[model samples]
Target chain A: MSVLGRVRARPQATAGVALTLPVAVFFVVFWLVPFLAAIYLSFTDYEMAGTPNWIGLANYERMFADPGFLNSAWITVVYTVCTVVPTIVLALLVAVPLSRPGRLNRWLRALVMIPAVMPLAATSMVWVIIYSDRGLANTLLGLVGIDPQSWLTSSDLAIWALVVMVVWKSMGLFVIILTAGLQALPGEVYEAAAIDGSGAVTTFTRITLPLLRRTLLFVLVISVAGSMQAFVPAFLLTGGGPADATQVLPYYIWANAFPYEHMGYAAAMGMVLLAAMVIVSALQFGFLKGGDE
Target chain B: MRAGTILRAVWLIVAVGFMLLPVYAMLVVASAPDDTDLRGLVFNGFHLPENIGLLFGEGNLPTYLRNSLILCVGTGVLDVIFSAAAGYAMAQLSFPGRRVLFALVIGTLALTPMVLVIPVFLIVKELGWVNTFQGMMVPGMISAFGVFLVRQFALGIPKELLMAARVDGAGEFRIFARIAAPLLKPALITLFLVHFLAQWDNLLWPLIVANEQELWPLPVGLANFQSEVGITYHLTTTAALVTAVPPFILMVALQRYYVAGLTFGGLKR
Candidate 1:
């Protein structure tokens, strides 16, 4: 008998299959079914109170035309860019030096991860206090000879304030991830560069950046997805407020679905968000294809 | 030390200070007397116990804390067990459709919680599980990332050990229980930490499904209290500190496992 046939005939193999059945079935029911339902609900007007009515493409059409949806989509893009770029740059700055093996660097690394481990809801509450009129942030700004700007109350500044908090909260994990990538880099390349008398800037730009492309891509994609789906800061700190300045897509979806009962409309917006994430991830893979080689 | 090393040391200290500043502010506010001036820094410890006591005595925070513990611990244990079992199967067994099953698992990784929230709520509603503990916990019991991580670790286990046990007429369950389970301890611990943190910090889904005040978890409860009371910094900061203490303790105690799991899950190549 063929090896495949022999393996299939064994009771142990059947046991393995049986062991996997519970999770697989659970996922199918909870994950796969709901995912399909989300798509189906996107195409229909399914209010929680009533049965779904078939209304193909109308929800998507409304999504494109609605000012709230358009504004949220724009805000989401801006937030993602603002948060991801600064996070990667700052994390890289901290991580490169911290990657050096030392007692101090090790302690610093643990210290930085504290914010990332804390619950965002709790942290957002703390930030709301900091952004208050007579809060510590303003006190620090006053010491630097600046005015106490309204952080979460200003239309233009609220989104930026949210960005700052998010970057602070998330940078630790990225720093750790990038540090691992840095430590994994072969030291012989650095030695060769040093022998050639390559300057620090040139070595970093040429050797370190190119080799860390895969890790950078990983960080970038995760950060973009995270920033896109961010809800706690908006919900807790600003309530997507100061005239909807910080009203990103996920918050918009929540508003429409729960409070307004526009479940179908929310589902359509969610589909758009999913599509955007998939496209971003696919483009990242395509762009970084040569990094592995 | 050289000038460059000194500069780097200064920068590291500043970075650490920046990271801890907000937390320090939280501690100050939570522990400050209610009528104290809120403008400048007031680091006091007199009101710490009183504020925490008020949070529990005046509000439903103790119930929320209990619910959070139930959900996080329940989901953590279940996620580890389910993921380990499926991971072991994919690693050691030669069953048909294994490749397809594994691919499906990986595919689910791309589906974020935001995307699943609405439909999952609908499913819970359909099953009449809204406002219940099982509603909050059951749907999230299995994590795709956990399964992937465990599978990667399980692949490193030698296949010969399992084959040896099988040849000795031991049942597959016996081999898994007596042999594979112990070998998977490190991976399971890592997976448990990851799932526990995720569940512990979860806010959105719980807010949607558990509308009943008695059923609310820490995040949702804290958020509701903030909005309802409209920014009473002393009480809110105390609540925040109370909510943050569990994960803070866990991260500090199991720092290595927490860091490893996060980095491992992120840079899975």
Candidate 2:
């Protein structure tokens, strides 16, 4: 009722308040209020008990000098760059071929999504086995005669292992997206290009790539956002690693908020994560420019 | 076949093989006998029932399953209703600040949900909702993506149909329920399924708030099974298969709709 009252109190929103009340409540409770609280929380020293003491900019200052915080920030950037670039490239590689119609292509289309559609937490567990000493990774490597490497335990490989898991699980959905983009390419344009004696690469670069820009931008932004928020794989597969190799920001932020009870620090990190996503996502808007379509 | 065709086939095979290899390992481990080597994907004999029993018995899987279902189904239903109602109102009904509300919806769709985690946790904790069902479910009940999906679809709905309902003396909410709703079925289904999967796949939120084991969702429970010390590979594999297999099978069963829903959901975000 109070939520309703406040929602109605908004200037010039009186009419149809009944209809918009739930949405307003959700906006206020979930988005508006929490968002503002996050701003305030980041400036304080709240540890889930006692009053929050204001210490403006201290949390943000501490992050630059804190090794663990810096490690997480650096790894998160590495994780995103490693993931989003490969995912888009790999998805394009698969999507272009799968765009055409065939029985096998149809099967492969759905096959790729099996990983994406499943729960990440559950699939991360499967990755745990895959990276295990005697698991499929080793089995396959033995066939190639490469000695087994401690994949998840090795600090160098732990983040890469999680990267592999994330790419495997997430790339397929992007494949589907890019495939849709490819298929939507005007067939006559491709025919015209081929008639002009254009090679496959030329046709792709000039025709297909230019036309797929919108969908590519869509995929790029979403993948960037998804990778920015990834926590489950790090949590499940590597437990943030033998060292801090895979302690991406979400996992590290959760550790601080819950285990260490550093609520204010986590809030500050969350703010930075949000700001980073906005900045990175804005850079991706560059994809939208210079496009005639 | 041309050389290009052969090359494409090889690429497809390698790519598809990469996707399915882990799933195959999961199946083999899940199917292996109880005493079979955990280190390998040895299939001595099928012991699926025994593993199922182990999960149900000692694994306390049912509780986790129920928790996930409660969170998933509840969030789905609430999401559909709220998004649909609001979408209809903002799209059709004359309301003050509709423009502002519309802007807010788009604003939320642009924001990453990770930043909301701390603030929402603080809110839930302040409400003493930690380890509670509402704590797990309520904050996630309405997504801007769902609202945006519904509003876009609802905008295409002929205003005459809704106006006719209003002319027949039906109330606003009633018109939405009876007329606007049936028209928005496809979008609503997409919204529901997408949010359902989101809730089910969610780990970070449930992990933060649902500290008690009883309230843990499958992802949380399943991750715990894998990450905890001294757990055998078989049990963890079984849990993994159990958590993963259903959604895949469900996706396969509803292959076209599932893909369409996911793509729509993904692209919209």
Candidate 3:
């Protein structure tokens, strides 16, 4: 109490006070201001040009009935499932063996992370080329004497193509994360499984999978959160075309908010996405925390 | 052992191949001199220099690259510094409302900026920050993930070290610069790479904030390249390659930091 009193008595707390003020003010002006304004504007019919008129829950009600909104929500769910499952599984399978420290492991791990750091927009563009009818992918298929399927334009296939690109770009970070978990695991558990004549698959399923639960949950939570808000690739590659196949939630929000000037409706959609992310993340955290106990 | 090792090697080869295909394709398309054979599978001929010259000659490729570098460096430095300072405060200092502030930071991470983009656009418009680099980078300069990363590292530093410094008449800021900051070198480097990559690859915000061609970053610049050069695959791809190269170089050079920073958020011990 005396040390605290003495610290409070110091004059520097007042002088040093001014230094922290700028950061506080900066955070408030940029983050808090926009966030609070958004919450307010979400309840009002505020097109860009004029003053807002209060219309409570009208935006939310309209969003619920909008087929585009519903479709985007479904597409987002599918995208989340497609991207998350493959990324986590592939990363874990790659990671378990690469957990050890060695020259070969180091190089292999580096290779895995290459895609994770690549500029996504550039990669998406490259993918647009590869997914072209006459592009490298089809050309390679030609080598194998298989037909070149439309990857981007086809309504049935466009979202999957986007999913494939996302998984390829994002799986590296998952690998690195899962590999870290593998390395940090107690070696004795795997040794015990090995001594019991457990094969690779057996050890993986029995020993590794259970131990990596928390890491898996973390990856899933983040992936789901990210996928639910997918925008850039969907915007660039598909443009939500071919009957709105690749139109995910964030794309819907962007369209409504920016181009349509339906600020209130977009805000309602944003709130929905925000709720989805929060619920999924909370569920994952709760499950993981319970597992820890 | 032979079977398992072979399987692992094959799996790695396949994964690595899939991983580099985009990069390889970017390079291939960029370097292909003529549109004579867009259907070719083999990547044999490439006039990379010619394509690069063509792209730069087209419109503002050099300036776009410069703008990207400026925005990325500016955002990276400012984000890392602010996040580090705030993380240190949250981790070490017994300030009032610390819990609330920390929760607020973490909560910000949950609301993906994509959802906030419209509101942000309105705010930027209100401030008349449109078409400015400051407008592009300033709003993104405080990342919750950056704070989380720094805090994870800062928590590892002993309180005694800071106490000893304070006892020797070192101010809190001096102590941070002299002792705590150096101790956080690895973490700071990792966070910097993450921030730099995020900023470098950011497209939507920059697209919304700046309409001037001169202010466009690499991603936005590449998007416009195709429009301007209509069907000039070589020039477009070449500019795309230019956009792709910096992040690739950064990844290769700082692989450890990049990987660690990336996984830190997702992988708990």
Candidate 4:
């Protein structure tokens, strides 16, 4: 096309063309820049005071060698595993039965969403009350003739308190997601399994489980991602210790960056987190895909 | 069929029972008389008025409520408008590097403020927005999740609508305001509620940003309530119950929209 033709056609390009710059700018400065800067800062000593000295691999070397960092990393993995697996499985166990079409089932499914909307701080406070030595859990345990457990204050049990809170807080979303998956499954498969004289467990194991892989995968990824970055309940309830038991990596980053002002080192840890998440997720996705094939 | 129905009925009851317990416990504990020890799960009365009075009596709770209202509403309005503008552009506009732009928006979801809390604080410090309303609202205004959500919803609108509006000489902004905005109401409300609740319940950011008592939102205020005040289970529960009321009402009133939003939100990723 001639230059004049292209110039004359410019009027048509006006609408879509105008919006591109501002959106592109936001993407560059806020999203892309911060991310790349995080990566670059990870490799340097860029504390706010001094020029960001380029220190090759020292921060990472320290990270690997640091006992506290290693502990938190291990705790993060455990926390992720405990929270994600049971939340998905338990949600599915609850959802599949509740997926049946009925008024009561509808009510139950809707009721499950209450937890997801409850403010995390409030819920954690409530859990603190419930798990207190004199709280509801102990009261119940007393009814069963078992002694009260110090749920949140003890090192051995503090992280489990965190795990319980996370599971309860996040389980509602999983229920909603997996229930939708449950509702979408073909009824004929279940009917066919029944006709084949398969029992309830057999039908669920042989039929329903296989069909729900994608939803399960989605739940797994979100749960893992969410748990790895869990902040509210831990921050509120445990304060990252009864001896640093509940101190996950995000908490470490928060403390180092905000409280301690080790911005560059914290940035290094954040990069490590980001890389760990992406690599782990990519591997999981690949493994799941391979399994499906 | 009969056995299966019985089993399903039993399961539903159990699930609902479990789900309602904590909420029921919250209300029950809140309503218990101040001097009475609410060590058990049983519900009580006569304490609602007393506890509520305690919360609002000295104007402390009222201040927290007001701050929460300002932050939540401000964040909602700012997030929705910017997200709509950016989303509409992404969906309707065919500008250069559009793919890269959209990719960047989606990419931000994977990167959360937890990792960048310090850097963000630095940015807020540089802008002199620390311990200020602008600091709280402005930084959160550009949520990637909000933009991504609105853009996905906006993409469903037919181009013919925009073309027809253009044929009538309607300006881009006008079409968006008159046509696209109204059409995107459901998604807007969804995003609004999500962001509002998120901000309403937010702790770390608000705690980090707003150091003053007057500027503190409910979560931070409540946190301080436990620490600074004379700690009583009754008063704490009262504060917790009061904190939950706004979001509870919002979730109930917008139940249908909330469910649809959750479906769109959860599955969209």
lDDT of 3 by residue, A189-270 (tens): 9778878999878888878888888778878887777777778889778888778999998888888887888887787778
Q: How many backbone collisions does model 3 have?
A: 0
Identify the leading candidate in terms of DockQ: 1
Give the docking tier of candidate 2. medium
How far off is residue A59 in model 1, in Å? 0.7
Candidate ranking under lDDT, highest first, comes to 1, 2, 4, 3
Evaluate candidate 4 and give its CAPRI docking class based on DockQ. Answer: medium
Q: Which scores better on DockQ, 1 or 3?
A: 1
Superposition error at B108 for model 4 (Å): 1.1
DockQ for candidate 2, please give it. 0.56
**Residue B221's lDDT in candidate 4:** 79
Residue lDDT tens for model 2, B62-175: 888888888888888989988888887888776777888899888888766666887888889889999899999888889998888888788888977865765576666677
Candidate 1 lDDT, A139-236, residue by residue in tens: 89999999999999999999999998999888877887898888888899999999999987798899988988878988888898898889888998
Error of 1 at B85 (Å): 0.7
How many residue pairs clash (N, CA or C atoms closer than 3 angstroms) in each of the candidate models, in the order given? Answer: 0, 0, 0, 0
Report residue A28 deviation for candidate 2 (angstroms). Answer: 0.3
Model 3: residues >4 Å from true position, as ranges? A1-5, A8-20, A100-102, A290-293
Candidate 4 lDDT score at position A26: 57
DockQ in order:
0.67, 0.56, 0.54, 0.52
Clashing pairs in 3: none
**Residues B1-269, candidate 1, lDDT per residue (tens digit)?**
38878898889789878878888888888888773545437676568898887777767789989999999999999998889899988888777778888988988999866668889998899899999989999998999988888889889889888877876878887888789989999899988888888898899989888889999999998887766543377788888899889998988888878877866844566
Q: What would you estimate as the lDDT of candidate 1?
A: 0.86
Stronger candidate by DockQ (2 vs 4):
2
